[model samples]
Target chain A: MAERIALIDYGAGNLRSVHNALLAAGAGDVAVTDSADIVRAADRIVLPGVGAFGACMSGLSALPGMIAALDEAVCRKNRPFLGICVGMQLMVDSSEEHGSHKGLGWIDGTVRPLAPSDPQCKVPHMGWNDVIPRGAPPLLEQGEAYFLHGYAVESDDGADILATTDHGGPVAAAIGRETMIGVQFHPEKSQRYGLALLERFLKWRP
Target chain B: MTLRTRIIPCLDVRDGRVVKGINFVDLADAGDPVEQARVYDTAQADELCFLDITASHEGRETMIDIVERAAAVCFMPLTVGGGVGSPDDARKLLLAGADKVAVNSAAVARPELIRDMAQRFGSQCVVGSIDARAKNGGWEIFTHGGRRNTGIDAVAHAELLASLGAGELLVTSMDRDGTKDGYDLDLIRTIADRVTVPVVASGGVGSLDHLVAGVIEGHASAVLAASIFHFGTHSIAEARAKLAENGIPVRRN
Candidate 1:
């Protein structure tokens, strides 16, 4: 049987693009569904979204049995979990976008807006940015990918950070511990460098 | 660390094939959009922008099929433009796998469209595309593939778009377009000073030095060119290497 990859679709954003990207990355049995059983049983789980932190949390909350299912699959079973963009921010404790809103709290951190001191520096840091790898992750061996988020996760425990990218300061780009990984940048949209990372993640035994 | 100067390859698609020219005139056949995208992908171009030049006036929807096919094949982030006049259109393109959507005429006609799209789909996905021509003494906004004049100051409009929730600006000079003389530095500087968003300097990029000048002198976030790349005059790798040598900090292959 082919390895099943469950893509959580809570109607946040970029669900189809993420699904298509996985398919392009050679994922044979990718299913874009919010079913609890399928999510729990899948070999890998991908959470992808492109919206505000508060909005994403609400979407995840609105989903029937989604939080419980994701928690069971990631925290309990410790299956390979990957979060992209706002999905990565959702892994943190809270965000500052639309006032204070609670997140999944999987990682102890807060999502704050990027601050570029130069008056010319734009908000919602979009487009391709260079990823400066701090701790070596097998997936990021290729190079940097595209990032399109306004808020970034500032972890309480800095050791969880896998890579950093500079805009105003060194912002955390990727975070992981054992089987769970969260990336602020969109690996699916990062082009060749991103594809290589996804391939590595798919092939990772752990 | 210094930011890298980006080399972007733009494709003007008419009936699915990539065409090139100055001021959208004397259209020369480039190649198939999918094939051209793949070539740029392999060549290590920083990003790709596909503009459906004739989609809007034709009263047709944005080409989602071509966008999807190109997105599936190309590894880099794709920005799709032309005929995206509303949030729904922007949503459709994003759903079709566009990393960003560039809006020019629509945003000009209705400034609120930028804010609405940004609110719904996040600001990063919204790109404000400006086509400006120097007239009399100041730069004026030109719409409909540089055929119609909007009588809006280019610099002032760029600032307005940024404030209205556009995440980035793709500024193209109609005067310098297709001239291959190099980008209009004055226009780029003017717009760059006005907006905080990343400004992609388009039109009249002839050589690698011109690309470097665009980023350094113009203070632009990226440099976009058409004829230079389409005619096989300069490769992305070579341009990046040259930029890196000049201390511009480009992603090395």
Candidate 2:
């Protein structure tokens, strides 16, 4: 039987790129759709996002039945779900990018700007950086991934962090709970390691 | 984990085919944009640049087609430039799968365009491209594919672009472009020192040593080249190997 992968599209940015990347990562049954029924039916779910937190949250909530469908699929159904970049930020309790914007509250954290104590550290934190695994998550090896974001997840509990990266100081790179995982990097942009990670996500049973 | 230095391969496209020239003249066909982009991505190029040297209305449409096709197969970050007149133009390119849109002529004509792009797409997606030629005493910014000098001081304009919310700078030296001599380290160093954003050193890069100099001496966040990588004289793997040997950290392919 083929795996049905739902690449969620609630008009978030980088959807096309993520779709193309999912196909590249050997997902034979990848479908980019906005319908909750499609999302609820899929065996796996991938959410890709970019831009500011306020805008992204509005875009996601703009579709009437999206949040409920996603809640049922990810939280209730316990399906394997993955969030990228701003999508990962949505897993936090809130974001401070443009003000305090509420998030999905799936993880105990707030999305805050990467204000490295050192003045030399640049904003947006763009480019490829190493993702050091804090605890072993299936198929997620320690390697570099392309990261481009000004804000990151400030997890309330250290146990929620699956990985970390340094930009003047250590920042949350990936978070995990059961089969659900979120990464603050662009696997589509990170060549080999990214493809490998995606392949692992596809084959991940837990 | 450390942030790795990037190596970018730039492909100038005209009517959907890859073209090359020295200082933007006497163009020669290299290959298909899709082909070259796929090759570079598979080779693990940090990023690929697709510059539409011909900015005609029809050419813009063709560039979009090229981007869509290349993006379907290439997973790495792609930066598109060549006549982004407005935020809408940048938006179209970004929607078509470009990770970043570089503005040069339009940005030089109206500095507000840079701010507008940044405001719309966020500064992280806006790249300010400057082609500079050494003039009397210093370098002046050039536009229209490096055919015209704008008389604007390169460093001053770069600072303005940065202040206007440009996330990155792509500085090309006209004197050294296609010369196979080496990058203008002095020019790159000067502008890099003044800007807080990442600076990409473009033009000239004949040898591996030159790539090293771009990071070590010029202090560039990335090094972009055309002929060397296009002509197959040097590969991204080779450049990364050389950079690592020289004590610079680069992502392995």
DockQ, Cα level, model 2: 0.65
- Which pairs of residues have clashing backbones in candidate 2? none
Q: In terms of TM-score, how similar is model 2 to the real structure?
A: 0.94
Candidate 1 per-residue lDDT, tens place, A3-77, comes to 999998887768766876787788889989878878988999999988777778888898888899899989988
Backbone clashes (count) for model 1: 1
Judging by TM-score against the true structure, name the best candidate: 2
Candidate-wise lDDT, in order:
0.81, 0.86
iRMSD of prediction 1: 2.0
Show the lowest summed lDDT stretch of 10 residues, model 2 chain A.
Answer: A117-126
Query: In model 2, what is the error at residue B97, expressed in angstroms?
Result: 1.4
**Model 1 misses residue A138 by how many Å?**
5.9
Off by over 4 Å in 2: A117-121, B21-30
- Candidate 1, residue B157: CA error in Å? 1.0
Residue by residue across B13-80, what tens digits does model 2's lDDT show? 88777776222222233366787787788788888898898757998899988888888888889999
Alpha carbon lDDT of residue B150, candidate 2? Answer: 89
- What is candidate 1's local distance difference test score? 0.81
In order of the candidates, what TM-score does chain B achieve? 0.92, 0.94
